[model samples]
Target chain A: MNVIDHVRDMAAAGLHSNVRIISSLLLTMSTNNPELFSPSQKYQLLVYHADAIFHDKEYRNAACKYNMALQQKKVLSKTTKVRPSSTGGTTSALQAQNLPSEIEVKYKIAECYTILKLDKDAISVLEGIPSRQRTPKINMMLANLYRKAGQERSAVTSYKEVLRQCPLALDAIIGLLSLSVKGAEVASMTMDVIQSIPNLDWLSVWIKAHAFTHGGDNQRCGTWKHFGI
Target chain B: MNVIDHVRDMAAAGLHSNVRIISSLLLTMSTNNPELFSPSQKYQLLVYHADAIFHDKEYRNAACKYNMALQQKKVLSKTTKVRPSSTGGTTSALQAQNLPSEIEVKYKIAECYTILKLDKDAISVLEGIPSRQRTPKINMMLANLYRKAGQERSAVTSYKEVLRQCPLALDAIIGLLSLSVKGAEVASMTMDVIQSIPNLDWLSVWIKAHAFTHGGDNQRCGTWKHFGI
Candidate 1:
C-alpha cells in the first residue's frame, strides 16, 4: 500500500498515538517524491497532523501547524486565481474547498489557546472573525471565551445571540444557567429551553429540579420530581 | 485465539467503539461454555466489559457495571473467606490486584456523576469515602467536586491537603490558583508551584505572564515576558 493509504488505515483505526510516526513517514515520502502531493493535499496532511496533535493535547504545536495550513491555503489561493464563490470572499473561495473554513481554523486555534489557559488570545482570535461570517457555533464559542475571560456581560450577550438564532442550543442554555447556578428566577426560562433538548435523562431532570429548588418555585420543583427523578 | 484473547486484541487496537460487538461476543462465549471460566475469570471478564463501556463514554452504564463488579467481588469474598492484605482490605484483597480499588470504583462513579452534571451526587459519593482511605488523589477529586458544587471553602481546604501531601501536585495548585485567578498575591505562590512542573513550555510562560499582568505585578510580568513569551 502507498504511504498515504497506510496513514489513512492508521487514522481509520483510531491509532492517534501513531501520529508522530505517520508524520515522520510522510516527511520521508515527501522528500523521496517531491511532486507526489498537490499543495492542497499537503495542506490536508498538515491539518490531519494538527488534529492528531490537538487530540494528544499538544495545543501549542497544533495551533502552530493550523496556522501553517492557513498560510499555505492563502498562498495556494493567490497562485490559483480562482473566482470567488457565491458565499465566501474571492481569496477563501480559491483555497482548498475540501479543507475546513478559515473561520473554522481560527476557531480551532482559539480552542487550543483556551485549552492552554490563554483566554486573552482565545478571545482576541474569536473577536477577529468577520461579524457576517460568525455562525451560531461561533457565537457559542465566543460566549464561552468571554465567560472564561471574566467578561460576564459580553458572554451573556453572545450567549443570548446564540439562543436567539437557535433557541434549543444546549450549550447556550447551559452557559446562561451556569451564570445563575446558585440563584433563582431563571428556572422558568431554563425549563423552556430544556424542552428543546430531547432524551430527558437524569442530567436534564436534575438540572430542572436544581433550578426550581434554587428558584424557590416549589410548585415547579414538585412537578419535575413527580415526573420521576 | 480464545474469546478473551480476541477481546484483549480489540482493546489493544483502541477499537473501543466496538464495545457493543465485544460485549455480545463475550456474552455468547460465556453462554456456550458456562463452566469454561473460573469465578475470578468471570469477575475479570465483567471488569473488562465495564472498562470497554467506560472507554466508550457510557458513563452511566459504566458506573452501573462497575458497581455490579464490586457487588460480585463482595459475594465472591463471602463465599471464599479471603484474608486482608497489607495494601488493601478484606473484600478488595480478594479481588484482582490489578483491578481498581474499592475507593477507586467509588471515585469513578463520582466522576460519572460529575460528568452528568450531578454535582450534588458527586459530592455525596466522594464524601462517603472514609477519611483514612482518602488518598491524595481522592482528596484532589473531592476538592474538585466541592468546587463544582460551589463549596469553595471546602474545596480550598481539600486542595490544600493535596498540596500538603505532595507539594508538586499540579491539579491542586491549579485548583487553588483558579480560585484567585484574577488576584495578585497568589502569583508568586503560583510561580513557586509552577517551578515543580517540568518541561515548561511557552504556554506555561504565557500563563504566568498573563497572570502577573492581570495581578498588576509589573516586575514579575516583565520578567516573564523577558524570558520570550
Candidate 2:
C-alpha cells in the first residue's frame, strides 16, 4: 500500500500517536511528487498532523498545524474560486471554501491559549468572533474562560447568553445557579433546564449539593431529593 | 511577615506560575536558614513548592518535591511520636506513630506516580494496599487507573469492590457498569445503580453516556442515547 493508505490505516486503528511519523513520510514522499495531493488531501494531511500533535500533548504544535491547514485551504479556495453550494456565498469565500470556519478556528485558538493558561490571549481570540456567529458552544466556552480568569460577572453574562441560545446548556445554567443570585432568577432558570434537558439528573444532584452547601431553601433541596434528580 | 510568609501567601493565592522566582527565593531562604523550619513545616512548604512545580509544567520537579515531602513526613513522624488529637488515631502505638494510615500514604504515593504517568509504579503502590483496609475512594481511583492501563477486568473488579463497600459510590457504580459484560449484566447493573443512587437522573445520564459507549448499544447514541439505555 501507498503512504496515504498506511496513514489512513493508522488513523482508522486509533493510533493517533503515530501521525507525526506518517506526516514526515508523506512530506518526504510529496517532495518528490509535489502534485501527488490536491488541496483537500494536503489539508487532510495537516489535520492528521494536528491530531498527532494534540494527542502528544504539544498544543502549540497542534495549533500551528491547524493554522497551516486553514491557510492551505484558503489558498485552495482562492485558486479554485469554488463556491460552496450552501450559504449562497453569504460567507466569505475564504471561510466557505476552508476546512473549518473562521469562528471555529478562533475558538480553537482560544482553546490552545486556555490550555497554555494564557487567559488574556484566550479571551482576546474569543472576543474577535463576531457577535452573530457566537453560538451556544462558543458562549459556553467563553463563560468558562471568564470563570477561569476570575471575572465571575462577565462569566454570568456569557453563560446567560449560552442559555438564551440553547436553553439546555447544563454547564452554563448550573454555573449561573452556583453564583450568589436572586431567588426568582435561579428558580426560573433551574426549572427551565429541568424541562429542557431530557436526562439531566446527575447535573441537578450536583447543583443540589452546591445549594445545600450555600443554604438554599429546604423546599428546593427537598424537590431534588424527592425527584431522585 | 518574613520572606517565607510572602512566598506562602503567594502559594495560598494560587499564583503558582512563577516557579522560577519561587524556587529561587526558596533556595536562597533555605540556604540562609537551613534549620529555620520544623520538619513538618518544611514538609508542608515542600508540598507547596511541589504544587508550584506541577503548575509550571515541571513534572520532574514536582515529582522530586512530592518524594521529598513523603520522605520528610516519614522522618518527622519517627522523631515526633506524639499522637495528635486533631485526627482520629488507633490506640496502637505503632499505627499512631505514623502521620496517617497506610492507605492515606499509599494514596499520596499513587497520586505522585499518576502525575508522572508511571502507571506501573502507580499500580504497584495502589495494589500494595491490603484488601481489607482499602476504602471506597482509593478503590475508585484504582479502578480508574486500571481502566487507563486498559486492564478492563481489573478495573471492573476494583469498581465492584468500591460499590460493595459503598453502594452510593456513584462514580464507582458508573465505572463498574461501564466495564461489565453487555446484555443482561449491564442492564441489571444499570437498574441496580438507578435504584440505589440518590441522584438517579444524573447517575443515569453519566452511565448511559459512558457505559453505553463501551456496550455499543445502538439505541443509545449521541453521547448516551445509543443503547436505548
Candidate 3:
C-alpha cells in the first residue's frame, strides 16, 4: 500500500498520533518531489493530516490544512474533467477509497471555525453550499450559527427547513420556539411533516408543552399536565 | 438501477412514502421469486423497507424488518465464508455499496425497541454486540436505556465508557452527575480527556458548574460566576 493508504489505515485504527506523524512526514517529502503523488493523493494526505490535527485539538492548524486540501481537491476535479472518459471511474474509485467528500471537508472547516469562535466564518462556509445540496445536518449547523449571530429571521428559516426534513429533531423545534416563532405556526409545520406517522398525537402535545414553557406562558404550560406531561 | 437501489435513492431524495410503498411491494415479490435476489440484495431491501417503516413511525413493524435483515446478513456472512478467497473482495464490495453494517442494524433495532418502550429488549439488543465493537453511540444508547431500567451501576459504566471515547459529550457528563457520581471524580476524568487541548481550562470550570448544579450545591455553583459562568 502507498504511504497515504498506510496513514489512512492508522487513522481507522485510531492511532491519531501515528497518522499525524506519518502524514506530515510524507507531505513534507512531497514538496521536494511533487511528481511523487497525484493531486487526489495529495488532497487525501492533507485531509488525513488535518483530521489527526483536529483530533489532537489543534483547530487552527487543522483548519489551514483542511483549506489546503480543499484547494487540492479543486485542482483534482479540474484535471479529472480534462480526461472525460475516466472521470466517472476516478470519482467512483475515490469514493470507494473513503476520502472525505467536498461537503464533508467544508463541514470540517466550519467545525474548526466554530471551535475557534469564528461564527461568521463558519456561517459563510456553510452558506456557500448550494441550497439544494444542503442536508439536514448542514441546515442544523447554519440554524445554530444564525441563532448565535442573532440573525433570528435566517435562523427561523433554517430551523423550519430542518424540521421539514427531520420532524423528530427536538432541538430544531425548541430553536424555532425560542426564536419567538408563533407556537401555532411551529406546531402546524411540525404537523405537516409528521402527518404520515400514525398515532403520534402525543408528539403535538409534547411540542405544545415545550412551546408554552419557552414562551413563559405558564398558564398554558400548566394545562399540559392534563396529558400527564 | 435495481429496485432496491432505486428505493435507496428515493429514500435519500426524501421520497419516504414512495420508498415505503415500493420497498414493501418489492419485498412481497421477493417472497415468490426468491431466486431473483442475491442474499446481500435481499438484506439491503429489507433494511431499506425497515428504514422507510421506521421513518413513517411504524416502530413495531420496522423492528421486525430490521431483525429479519440481521438474520439475512448472518446467512450472507456464512455463505461468504464458504468461498474463502473471494471473502475479502465481496466484503469490500459490500461495504462500497453502503449497506448497513451488522452493528448499525443492531443499533437501529435497539432504537426501535427504545421507542416501543421495551427497555429490556433495547438493552439486550445493545448488550448482545461484543464489547469491543460497541461504539460511543451504542454505549450512549445503552447507557440511557440502563438508566431508564434503573440499573444504575451499568449505566454509570456505560456513561464513563462514552465519556472516555468522547470527552465533549455533554449529555454523558450530565448523565454521570445525575447518577450521583462524586463531582470530583467526574471532573478529574474530564480533565484527563481535555488536557491536550490548549486554552481549555475553562472546560473544567464549565464541567464543574454542571456538576455543582446537578449536585444542588448552590454555593459552589455561585462561585463559578467569578469565572464569568
Instruction: Name the candidate, 2 or 3, with the larger DockQ value.
Output: 3
Residue A135 displacement (Å), model 3: 1.5
**Backbone clashes in model 1, listed as residue pairs:** none
Worst 10 residues of 2 chain B by lDDT: B93-102
Candidate 1 local lDDT, A25-92, one digit each (tens): 45545556767665665666676667778867799999998888788778666656664453467546
Q: Name the regions of candidate 1 deviating beyond 4 angstroms.
A: A1-9, A28-36, A82-97, A100-104, A130-138, A161-171, A178-229, B1-229
Query: How far out, in Å, is residue B138 in model 3?
Result: 16
Residue B85 error for model 3, in Å? 32
- Candidate 2's displacement at residue B220, Å, is 56
Q: Estimate TM-scores for all models.
A: 0.41, 0.41, 0.51
lDDT of each: 0.62, 0.62, 0.78
CA displacement after TM-score superposition, residue B12 of candidate 3 (Å): 12
TM-score of the candidate numbered 1?
A: 0.41
Give the CAPRI rating of model 2: incorrect
| DockQ category of candidate 3 | incorrect
- The list of candidate 3 runs beyond 4 A from truth reads A86-98, A192-195, A224-229, B1-229
lDDT of 3 by residue, B87-157 (tens): 48876575546876788889989989988989899999999999999987788888888898899999999
* Top TM-score hit: 3
